[model samples]
Target: MSEQRTVPETETETDTETPEVVAPEVVAPEAADAAAAGLPAPPGGSGRSRRVLAAVARWTAAVLVFGGVGAGTAAGITAMERTEVPGLATESDGRWEYPRLSLPALPQGSPRPFTDGNEGEIHHADLRALLLPAPAGAAVDPKANGGWTTRDAFLSAYGKEDRPPLARALDDSTLRHIAVRAWTMPDGTRSSVHLLRFGSVGYAEEFKDALIASEGGGVVPDILPEGAAGAKMETYGDDIDVPDTRPYIYQEPKPYGPEQIRWAYIQAGDTLAVVRQSRKGEAAHVPFQQTVTLQNQLLG
Candidate 1:
């Protein structure tokens, strides 16, 4: 698998600007009866205090949901203490495991709609995981105004040429519902891949449009994601370009897995590349060469 980049893969990795302080959280006052009843607080707060209250409220709700005695919202906490993830329970040494993605990469723009073995193996239903710290250069832009991701950065990572590869190969007619799972590394590095039912570029375009709008704060996250009420996202490039279907496209934020995972769409190769980064621990970053090699083997 030879990943001969028509474009020279940069020797340096992207680093992050220091994050701006999130406004201090403010917890709206709860009614005394509600407090006494121990009903969960309505989660609207300004800064850090709001965060603390929200956490407490979630624990209380979890307890109630899990039905723990002396338990209020804390049931979730207790359950989590006793519970174990199916695979995460095993704490092997720092080894990287590529988890199969749950979705297929929309590649209408690529020479190959799916991936070829020589260029890079298509990572549909697979993911790469590691315990390593984020690569030295990855960091979230503090001034991105709490943006989801930056466009210049994404282009730097995914590039315009890559976008065409996907556009060229994917079958717009086959697309059904397209879903995306994205993750932001604590160090500010981010990654994501769009999932779709083959040939359904409509969903893909709709998603891209939604992302462009949301990234600019022209739209809000809660308006679309009935599931996610408050989190916000940001974008980095020119508005998503999907013509013939809709003149405009904007992306709505999506949720995948648990924990604060930051995700976004970046055209990596013949397929959409999905990258996940954790906020607290080091994100496992494969050397650019390794990533290219893997992609070429999978896609070539």
Candidate 2:
């Protein structure tokens, strides 16, 4: 397992209301006796003081009762599991259970990629530490186990015929590092994430533009993933709102063979990430989207 830096999960605060306290009617003994005897009670006597004291006692008791109920409700909510709470429980949505994620520490005196004063927008952290971790129960690929990889290893995902030109482009693009992580889930879904860091944001954007060109009324990558004859741009049903990142998602068109492939190219600062997921029959949309969005977030 690769060493990771993790941040605390955000805490959610729940608001609980105290039930209203309604004081019961309190009558002085002298007043009740006088009313029963059809005679008025003496004014300005001890009855007024007794009534005031009795009312104060009743109010105090009501306050204590309601306060205890509110405290108990809060405690019960805190003790219960998140899934046990009504309206707060999240049902299974086919999303993978990934490990907690946090940005890696940068070298002392180095600014973050997207922070002010870093005009080039270069990532100062270790590339391997930035790679997304494999989801729970995934079988990780040793060759691409969240570590540095050769350019050829990254190019191997594309068809052989396109490798030569892509290699030349990478050389000219000032590619700095390539960090990859690949895994397969129990459901037979294979996922690979590649982060290619360039010398600057300009070079990264240029290489990304060169890799993807317009084709047949849509944009498609010049070098398609291995086993994918053709792919088309796909718009995600849900919006991915990572800051300072742009994702170009593509899906293998219909009439695919035994398996289907879905991939995305995320351009963020000096890093361009390739996230791919394939499965027999059909590639699940939820997991692919989830993977791409998360990778983009990490890069951002």
Who wins the TM-score comparison?
Answer: 2
- Predicted candidate 1 versus true structure: per-residue lDDT over 212-294, tens digit per residue: 45433322231222222333444323232221111211122344234243333333222333333333222332322233233
True-structure lDDT of candidate 2: 0.82
| Local distance difference test values of all predictions, in order | 0.34, 0.82
Candidate 2 segments whose C-alpha is farther than 4 A from its true place: 1-82, 85-90, 214-221
**RMSD values, in order shown:** 26.6, 8.6
> How many clashes (backbone N, Cα, C below 3 Å) per candidate?
87, 0
Best by lDDT: 2
**Candidate 2, position 149, lDDT:** 90
lDDT, candidate 2, at 9: 32
Model 1: lDDT equals: 0.34
Backbone collision tally, model 2: 0
* Model 2 per-residue lDDT tens digits across residues 102-201: 8899999999889999998999999888888998889999988998999998988888877887888889889999999999999999999999999999
